[model samples]
Target: MIKYYYPDGSHCYRALHTAHAVFRNEAGALIARAEKPDGSALYEFEITGFELVVAGERCT
Candidate 1:
């Protein structure tokens, strides 16, 4: 899963590597706004059909 942090120090999570849909809500509109729970927005991106994967161990 993907762990997203907010500007206010809060965070959320999402499943990665799956053909699932992701979203973000801002000012009454849903867009690619993965903002930190602290109200901080993340890197600007227009993505779809991909899950978020957090940093973890790597296997070979």
Candidate 2:
């Protein structure tokens, strides 16, 4: 599972790891994805006018 959060919105997805494995260690400032609630195969990938909100991954 993976949850990509944007400034204005957020996404909770159940990724097919065998096909598209999104590793947290390799995701840099992004959240360390684990199992989450209300997940689906449906996903959206866009950061045009949004900012990624990660916890403790940045020095704010």
Candidate 3:
């Protein structure tokens, strides 16, 4: 699930994003996501760092 992902407070200086995460199952793999707050998949979404996502919510 997407929510179970843990967010790191950095998006790298080259790229600007509020959240960056990696699934618990993966190691040393960084990820970027733009899903809606309601757990719906977004064709195009924006990140403002104010999302109330949990640690186990799925996105689709």
Per-residue error for 37 in candidate 3, Å, reads 13
Measured on C-alpha atoms, candidate 1 has an lDDT of: 0.42
lDDT order of candidates, top first: 1, 2, 3
Clashes of 3: 4
List of clashing residue pairs for candidate 3: 3-55, 3-56, 4-55, 4-56
lDDT of 1 at 50: 31
Question: Residue 32, candidate 3: how far off, in angstroms?
Answer: 1.1
- Between candidates 1 and 2, the one scoring higher on lDDT is 1
Off by over 4 Å in 1: 17-54, 57-60
Which runs of model 2 end up more than 4 angstroms from their true locations?
Answer: 16-44, 47-60
Model 2 pairs whose backbones collide:
none
Per-residue lDDT of candidate 1, residues 1-60 (tens digit): 765444455555554432133465464332344444444445443432232454453211
lDDT of each: 0.42, 0.34, 0.33
Q: Whose lDDT is higher: candidate 1's or candidate 3's? A: 1
What tens digits encode model 2's per-residue C-alpha lDDT throughout 1-60?
233454456643334341232232344433333333354453333321221234323211
Among residues 3 or more apart in sequence or in different chains, the pairs in candidate 1 whose N, CA or C atoms overlap within 3 Å are 5-36, 6-36, 6-37, 6-38, 7-36, 7-38, 7-40, 8-38
Ranking by TM-score: 1, 2, 3
TM-score of each: 0.31, 0.24, 0.19
* Alpha-carbon RMSD of each model: 11.0, 8.9, 11.2
